[model samples]
Target: MRVTSLLVATGVLLCSAPAAVAGPAVRIHDVQGTTRVSPLVGQRVTGVPGVVTGVRGFGSARGFWFQDPEPDGDPRTSEGLFVFTGEQTPAVAVGDVVAVDGTVTEHYPTAPEETPETTANQSVTQLVDATWQVTGRGAVPAEVVGPDSVPEEHAPLDGNIDKRELEPQRFALDHYESREGMLLRVDDARVVGPTDAYRALWVTSKPGQHANSRGGTTYTGYADPNSGRLKVESLADGPFPAADVGDLLRGSTEGPLDYTSYGGYVLEATRLGEHQPGGLQPESSRPQGEDELAIATYNVENLAPGDDPAKLDRLAEGVVEHLASPDVVALEEVQDNSGPVDDGVVAADETLGELTDAIAAAGGPRYLWRQIDPQDGADGGQPGGNIRVAFLYNPARVSFVDRPGGDATTPVHPVERLGGVGLSASPGRIDPGNEAWRDSRKPLVGEFLFRGRTVLVVANHFGSKGGDQPLHGRFQPPERGSEVQREQQAQAVRAFVDEALAIDERARVVVLGDLNDHGFSPAVQRLTAGGALVPLADSLPPLERYSYVYEGNAQQLDHVLATPSLRADYDVVHVNAEFADQVSDHDPQVARFTVR
Candidate 1:
């Protein structure tokens, strides 16, 4: 779940109903006034009735979620109702006008801004606990209409509204924001794409699974909101109709609707139009056996697997498209664990086999991974999981060569001592005096024969927390000196590169990873010698050299640097910053290099 700034400041407090008898119901006016003033926390007040504005089945079986507008009439303040386990009550359809008597609770609000006003008013509000019992039901409400009827001014306001009314608008706006300026839609209508119809199926299987599960599957299709041409995977019994570039669809609004499958990869129906021409496909295709290949990298923000395998299946499509498409893909934030039980599964069985399978299904090649073993005795977030780096290569274009010390089957070297100090002895707050630090994976390096030439690829995910802080930096620095640890990681990579240079003068190297430091940092300078790796496009300006765009500023934290010889064959055709919504925090950076 995305955490907004406001939610972060006030810890989400939960108030439970009284045993058996249920808590007393309180008027909305009473709670609203107190919540606004002191924000009562963990208080169990009950009995408030409001129109059922919206209802949705949570991606998992966790239960249904409904939203109700403030009874006092302020749309800004809405209650997000979660009917969790044991509340297997009837499903609430959209617009089903029902009065519910239940507890008032606060979900984790995202972090609030550090401004003086917000910081000073960070008191949390508690909800009254009353067993929500549905009183009555009726046809979906009209005021809670679909996306087409929602005004732009009311888009971000969260209340229970007609699912039909809100969905299309939300879908359209999100798509518009995601695809701004890159492509245009025809007739501004909707049509189906390859993956749209199959979203429900995908979500049911993998709401938030890890990237390594092989059993995981994904579907791709599109939808035409205006024309009501919604094509989803299950909607059509088979393959979807072929669509070429520039096909225009008609008759759709921007709203959230479930497009089920019709026969032969067709959409059953569409409620709203997210954008024109339904779904998006790459306009340009890579020619088969082309002399050149495109290499890309992305962080795939929080691509970790949930405790359940089902959540992972839901997210397969986004992960596959974002991180697994390139000829040589490097991934950061990958987890490795060793123990009897992991995420409720056997340790030996928890590898990301599902993700690898999803990539192969998408016509991408298979992946091979290397990770550090967690220490025997360690205490932290989740035991047995280690964050490391891995690679997925197209076997047709690349072959692995065994180094004398590091064979094909051998694992990458473990930098037990970071920046010339042991993990326990490191001067950082996060891991200070932690002996199990070696168990934390550092960098994974390998030799790949790309286009008949050997290229050394090093993939790393550096320390993010525990960095030094500047007094006024927009984002607070890590308390443990994350800045220092990151520098040590950089030095480690450089050391690896220097070793490679000694092995073969003509050895081509490409350093691809999430370094945590931007392209302009002193650490990067120490590694690349002020653009010595040779900037791909001198004509493109420095601002465009970034792989991640955040807060209106472009930061080149994810990078692809090549040795001097390898630099001659490739030109930075273009880098993709578009997959921020579907896949990760960092967009994939793709560079096209002609085989010399």
Candidate 2:
């Protein structure tokens, strides 16, 4: 791994340091004999000093990494260096070089010839137990210079950087490669809206690392909007910043961003001109009323109640008071159980029972939730609390209709039964075929009547963190792999919408959930563009119109789109960060509308 070479070099330096005779340090040769030794294992030497090259804050405190540039042939190999943790500290940037005096300790060793890409190696590098102090300070050069300097291959155009927006994951990969090891300048970054922790800023830089299999190469000298600084990571010492966010980044050109990759990297951003404070305003100038229905969606930050029914009751009350108070609420990451599974529990009494009970207890209306039941035979969660998408609605405002051929007594897709017991029986099953159950997350659809008009509501939760493998076998290219499962979920909802439209051209429809894909993603676009379901907030500006924020940018992955007729009366009000902070990881988007 890249870090191994650095660490080996550091060991050599530490072993040879004591022999250096004091003076204006000149080139030192191997104080030790000429025989190469196996890399040091678990040596705990202390108080070596080096410059701070990088700093990362993972919420609570700042973590520092740096390099001690050694003279040529000093027996000190330039492999991995040291990292220290500082708690609740003031922020530190890239260019502000500080001397870190820490012990030379053995990092967890990797197996022979092991690659850095695997989880074992990744975890080992992040483990930090060493302690160090800031001994001295030096200012980094104002300009960056090197072969690793930002490349021109993927540079944004002269006047269009803000005109394009790429999907979140793809954008992260591209940005990572472009600025992996470069100095950068950022300006005027502020922690605005909701929580002060979420900082935003404009970035300027040359591109860095080249693209590799996992993703793009790290850009060496680009600015980070979130951290508000230029970044770098190197063995000689680094992960440093050239500038802070929100500062006027000079010597930069703006242009349209491009992301034409296969994992659907598409975004449309309008350049609103020169950077200015309080940049934009809401496009709609209408007032709102309490009687108008407000709909919110959230990925409810792992809202699972363990096994206890009482715990579920507590959870239900919270859900009712905070989440379901509005007219319609679409929730993702909900779990249920037929019973206990191997790792622990697999039941979802808390999500279903608690949520429903909470709504009723609050003296609010009842909610009808539909999910893929895993009891009979449908696949359940791998360990437990087989989570699924569910919907809660006020019965007084809407009622379900019986279709001509619809099976009212049976669910649309009944859980398949196996061996006289449901598939929920064994939660700890590790067979590859059993893994297929992960792909069975189904979309829940229901029809409700609002003021004599029938509106279709579809709630969905797609596949989670399985990493980029094609869907097993449902569709072919043009129609591809497991990604097809996501498409099918969208297609299922569209089919329901088509059915609604077939019955009446003016039929109203609203589709919402944790789609996993952004508004511009192929899966979402297939459902919204070209006179399909109209985007509810298309008239609103992007920032004011998002339900989720990630990696310094806001995205509307959880959405509420309406059929043409429903669009006229509805307007969206995105709550401020204060309100969203209490709700979930995803802020709820409330859509208020009047029934004509």
Candidate 3:
């Protein structure tokens, strides 16, 4: 015990010494001031010293962080710094008080080789080409920082970070950028989102967040309403714990701030505390009406044999438990039996059979399914994954109008039925030959008889907005080039709906699927033109209208629309999207309407 005490005293003595320096020392605060870029960037300096607080020796971000023992007392400046060694593998350890000789750089995480540019959430202040010698070893202090340390005001009113870059002290972007590479801590942070596949978690520091009627943060579409939510990025990947929405990360989470291509400004966490449930419950009571015919749209996210069986089982349970087994289900992204095998096998019987069996086992009626298999590699999703749209209907509640299935090249047209409107080909692909659907999921049109009424259901999965420029890119409110193709697909579906409406003025039509575009986009505009169809999402409160969450912002990408004649009400099911254990990335939407 005496020897141990002596060693502890000696270590503390060595670390407490004024970080022995060989040349002029520069304060970390002066280096990191109230600016998007570092003040002393691009200059080489010696005797820059601090105690190593953290070390990240993983991926492309191999570096160590240090913080001065005492801060400069300037709220607009940070006292911590990160020295990036790249592949050199610096011989340093955490808690080592060391002086570094290196070039100060404002490094952009996306384009690491190039000089820094003022792109939103792209840059980090760091020291590169560094050479450091540990003079002492002991514990280093990491000051706790949380939402209070950040700017109180929300982000810019226009929802663009570029405009607020000039005011680093006031704006959220500038404030977080100014504190880049700092050793920080967040206490009692609430996990607002699920832990994604990349081992990242989004948390909000504020208590009692405005959670939607369903779980997940509500998107008010106002200026930075969720400004307090920050991302927690794990430097050590793999074996990440799965967490649901509204969980609480209680205790001090210490780490160095980092900016990455994914999730922008993140804390590369080193020490994480315990997490507890945030009392988030899945939606239980489904839509109800005595004469209502319920319809639901769900993106199953490439379900196949090789997928996680537990997730698939939960998905089936959600359909029955949360959605109350809607009369008809418009399912998207149903993968082939062998999921991405690249063989010519395009059948999904095994996939659908298992899901149906699970649904039946979960107390739901046996659902009959219909879909046309797409040619291998024709539908764009995972490479070799031939995903397509399909429908699942409870035979007890609704009956499908059986007809011939259309091929990849066959185009189905709308026809005037004896009593109402129907498709020339049930389970037909609309405009399959159009370039707009070259590598995208084509729309599936089908006719259903519901409570003495003929209902036309169009299930579609349009082109995604993946190719669009990122919101944090050089472009503000980034351009969505993919909308053009989706617009064409929308027009085709709209034309078919118009033909159906022409045949019967009171045609009960429901268009539903993962539109892959926002409600206000041009594609939605074309889909709703002529007032023939109206998005049911508009009926929801703007704050609760979202069906998807990306970068902490809740927005709608999945939609359900109804013709004016259809007396329908919809609810965005909270079974997925907000939780990590979900079977799909999107929330399922269910609408109940009285038959015409």
Candidate 4:
């Protein structure tokens, strides 16, 4: 329950506004205004009457929310406002009716890690320099708004934030934006995602959604405008337990509407109802098969030397304890030894060595590693952090075939193996010079021998969706321009898979990595064209197929795709993605193949 310091000291100058004085009386709706930007912004107003709904003391923006007992009659304007009282506690409490005075301010509460280009300004509208006089104390009544009006339909298909801001009711984000600084409620809320480290919950009241075969929501190409999923921010200070996907928030959730840079519109909730677990567990059982050679793909999330030793320990334990120490592991985001220092150092042997030692400490067998270091700055990731894909094989269970011509720029081709085809370059890069891989992590191809069977593995870390617009941006659905690069990368990988299969029709080939796109995306379609190769995740139950959750949708970005001839059972380990206290941002995946 460690609250950040910056949020605790945000409004000193604003709260210090010239000693409280009698000011003009105004309605809550008047202060709310009818547009995205409040009309009364920067003006000091007083004598605003309302009932105290809740008090928040955790973060930097300490304050209490009040709701006008009487309606403003205009559906576009909200009848509630948050009066910033800073880190100090307020005299008023929930359920107390009072009259308050404060300066209207529109401010953006951006997190420190945000870049200048991505940091949105003036996103949240609030009341500052507040002073309130309590008149009476009584029970507060809750509003049941859901099923009928909790979430409005339609997001602009065209990518235009201006149109959304101009017409607040026309888009989903605009509709929520219009109700900024208001006490809102949602009834019959079902948890769409787990509670994160920030104690935020994502829920939706919509009955019909594009659910996976397992009843969990899937990322169906575009962000669904019709889905009623919304983020609920917990303002209280306490230990928040994780909720399962599809769990229910019994009764309702009530809070003041607030806008944040991460998830645009959210309800800073004063009250969240009971949680019912949907039988979701924190850890996934190891995949089983006697003749099976277990394989896993994990994006260690930029693991490098000289970083937090505890994080490296946890990641190693996750690989052994949670993933059951697969025979072969395809790891992404393996950074250089010096980490994010711009020293032009491009070796990762020490980085891999520490991880191997930790794995042995965690009771897992010592794993042999292989990878080719890319030219400095050639791989895209944290600047000075040259992240690349690597492999870790248990020498006891499998053997890495040593071949020639393995380097960063060399393209590995299929060669003859024992009754099958293996990679000509034992460990080499795939299409490094292709424009698609520029400033992105190139795919690492490795050849391994398991039980007299040759398994060709291509580990990849494709271009991310960083260039895509935000889901709540002006553009309704938000354009995914990064898909173009990923599609090209997929096509290149698919071509290699096709070549391997052509050399030997029964070639056992597995492609794994952080595709950085959904299973239903165009890139996936390109990779699995003609059913030559199939996503192993498709073989699992819909509810159990996801390896990543973004904006409340449980979907697979980390995939394990194998040729049609390979028999395998895939499991997206439920170890990291669901918990905020995770070693990595992604969930690792394990697939057991019956190769003999």
Of the candidates numbered 1 and 4, which has the greater TM-score value?
4
TM-score of 3: 0.86
Report model 2's TM-score to 2 decimal places.
0.52
- Where in model 3 is the C-alpha error above 4 Å? 1-43, 69-78, 87-94, 110-121, 136-165, 207-210, 213-215, 222-225, 234-241, 287-290, 472-475
lDDT of 4 at 548: 79
**Minimal lDDT window, size 10, model 1:** 216-225
Writing each residue's lDDT as its tens digit, candidate 2 over 1-596 gives 01111124333211121222222211101111111111222233344444444554444423543434443432222222325343432234443333322222222223232342221211111213343334346532212322333233332222222223222122332242222111222222221222222222223232222211111121221232221112211121222122221222233221112111211111111111223233222122233354455555556545554445554443344445444355666677676544334444445555666667766776656776544344322433344555656666666655554333221123232112321111111111112132323455555555555666545566666554244421111011122244555665566566656655665666556677777665666567778856758766566544345554433234456677777776443433333222212335454554665544
Query: Cα RMSDs of all predictions?
Result: 14.5, 13.5, 5.4, 5.7
* Error in Å for residue 130 of model 4: 6.8
Q: List, residue by residue over 1-596, the lDDT tens digit for candidate 3.
A: 00011124334321121222334468777677655567677777677778887787765657788887777776667777887766444456777888776677776655535644444345667877666656776665666666565664544444444323345456565566656667778887777778898788887765445656544566554344465667897655445557777777788776887777676677878777577777766775465576889999999888887677796789888899988889899999898998878888889888888899899999998999988888888989887678889899999888999778577779887788787778888888888888889889999988899877789899999998876755444334455688899999999989888888888889888999999987777898898988899899989776688777786656788999989998777888876777776677898989999786
Of 2 and 3, the candidate ahead on TM-score is: 3
What ordering of candidates by TM-score runs from best to worst?
3, 4, 2, 1
Instruction: List model 1 lDDT by residue over 249-367, tens digit each.
Output: 23332212211112111112213223233233421223324665555555644345443444344234433543335566666655543422344321222445656666666655675
Candidate 4 local lDDT, 52-94, one digit each (tens)? 8888876666778888888767777777778776676565678
Measured against the true structure, the TM-scores of the candidates, in listed sequence, are 0.44, 0.52, 0.86, 0.82
**Residue pairs in steric clash, candidate 4?**
7-60, 8-60, 159-475, 160-474, 160-475, 161-474, 214-543
Candidate closest to the true structure, highest TM-score: 3
- How badly does each model clash, as a count of residue pairs? 99, 68, 0, 7
Clash-forming residue pairs, model 3: none
